[model samples]
Target: MSNVYIVEDDPVIAGAVADHLATWQMQSRCAKDFEHILEEVEEYQPDIILLDIKLPYYNGFYWCMEIRKTSKVPIIFISSADDNMNIVMAMNIGADDFISKPFDLQVLTAKIQAVLRRSYGTALSIHKLECGKVELNLDTTTASVDGSQMELTKNEFLILKTLMEHAGSVVSRETIMERLWGNDEFVDDNTLTVNMTRIRRKMEAAGVKDFIVTKRGLGYIVGE
Candidate 1:
């Protein structure tokens, strides 16, 4: 199931989006902590985001800029600010689409499905990964927790992908090294450590606590 992250602060609208998506068997997460919107995005790492322009603290444009620095995942702006300037600004900042507030769920769902099919379905694959309630962005190599986005390096993305793919299994260091070695000109051991550390830091910031745990001589495990 594809996860949709809703950044709207209004409880009613957020609930409506979640309910609408659920009918299609599509899962969605609403941002509960407005104070840390990006953090929520990082945890829920939805396949796409339904962002509101007017928000607490910094507005949607600010968050959109922050998200652009990390992932190419689609972002659709939602707000009462329906003027052309807002729409133009949204598009200029890399927003995939814009929908004014009080939208019809059916229409919104159509748009969501269309965007998802265009952005991902055509790729000939589907994947789902999460750290607690947070979703991992397989396409952009990032994670969204509590509406916050966390950027992952190429190697860090790989390590997280490896561990996420085999959640409970202890991925051996040698196995990890082999995977890294096959990439480009072969990433060294030190490079792997750096990537792991970076990924762990990103994970920690998402409120994941201990995301990757060392298994002594064996290797690493994602789920404890």
Candidate 2:
């Protein structure tokens, strides 16, 4: 799972965003210690950061510059200052994206997704996951086994990716559904079943056998 750090000091906004991100299976943490922003970044090692412009002590631009000195992780500016100059300055200072204050949660999530996709690779952020002879390339969104390869649909790729992330652990069905649908709230159980079945068929076709295992009442697991 990708980790996102929220540098906004506003408790309400930070809490709401973190809660919404959780539904998408993305981990997030709000910045509590403004005095040690860089230290927090170092310890968290977040994949991405959401920064606010007007902050206590140092501003977002300063923190962004400091972060850029050591890491290439994506930084997105979120603030009430929506002037063209501030936006331009943010981009010039190394922010990957910028969101104006009072933005929709969906818009913020979309921007986050776009930034991550550009900073990292495609669908799956990490490069590849391997189990025995089978390999999944996150950038290409394809699974390969024994020199044979097969492309996976979006849902199939996510399902396999989730399983591989947990590996030996049994990922619950509810968790998988939340990752797949986010807050859609209307997904049926049969949809996930169909996706899992298709993933298994694709793996088999690509020369991979028994790659994903089902656990009676639990969800799925990749590695032994």
* Best prediction by TM-score: 2
TM-score of 1: 0.54
Worst 10-residue lDDT window, candidate 2: 120-129
Candidate 1 per-residue lDDT over residues 131-187, each given as its tens digit: 565677654556777768888665676677677767888999877766545435555
TM-scores of the candidates in the order shown:
0.54, 0.63
Clashing pairs counted in every model? 24, 0
* Residue 135's lDDT in candidate 1: 74
For model 2, residues 1-224, the per-residue Cα lDDT tens digits are 77999999899999989987764557999999997899999999998999999988999999999999999999999999999999999999899999999999767877887788898776545467777887777646677887688888868877877788788889999888887887777888899999999888887777677888988898778787
Error of 2 at 167 (Å): 3.4
> Model 2 clash pairs?
none
C-alpha RMSD of candidate 2: 5.2
